[model samples]
Target: MNAPLKITKVGNSAGLILPKEVLAHLNAAVGENLTVVFTTRGIELSAADPDFDQQMAAARDVMARRKRALRELAK
Candidate 1:
């Protein structure tokens, strides 16, 4: 599904307006969050995973706290 969206001004911030059909295709709605991942190809957008943020935060904390151990294990 390809959507050609235009960037527009929302108050002071610039954002893209996802058309209703596009949002429906994503199984998303207005005011709902979408996860955007920038891969080598381009930007990928999908419906947000509720626990993704928490899992990422936990992983970051673990990496920070176990930096030395992880580095050694990477050898």
Candidate 2:
């Protein structure tokens, strides 16, 4: 169900008022930063700091592609 949002003042900034249920569902908290991406479809938000599997995969791919160059540089 889409609930109505209340506009409130946060110091000098205006912010959207979210319900407790919504916050609990998202597992977000105050002062936490989320990555928000605006795509052609719509907006998407996720935790910025996720598992390191993707990073490790990227490093492996780069190393595989530049094995010769890296070997030369190591000397």
Candidate 3:
């Protein structure tokens, strides 16, 4: 869990080479965007634009409240 990553140069950009196991743990693929946050302690990498659960909850609320109106609009 505490694998160290060495910084390496990639053409004009600096990057790290993650092992296949680590990449699988991250569930990341090529071209996927990661949100990087630096704290006083360390850096955190996660999928960008979080709050997916919150967004889904809000969407459910909207769907529940608009069921009738949406049904009417559909006709």
TM-score of each: 0.72, 0.47, 0.55
Which residue pairs overlap in candidate 1's backbone? none
lDDT of model 2 at residue 44? 79
Better of 1 and 2 by TM-score: 1
Model number with the top lDDT: 1
lDDT of 3 by residue, 22-70 (tens): 7677778777777788999999887665577699899999989999998
Off by over 4 Å in 3: 50-75
Give candidate 2's root-mean-square deviation (CA, Å): 6.8
lDDT of 1 by residue, 2-73 (tens): 868899998999999878888888999988999899999999999999899899999999999999999999
- Model 1: residues >4 Å from true position, as ranges? 1-3
Off by over 4 Å in 2: 50-75
What's the CA RMSD for each of the models?
2.3, 6.8, 9.1
Model 1 clashes, total count: 0
Write down the worst ten-residue block by lDDT for model 1.
1-10
| Total backbone collisions for each predicted model | 0, 0, 0
CA lDDT for candidate 2 = 0.79
Whole-model Cα lDDT of every candidate shown, in order:
0.92, 0.79, 0.83
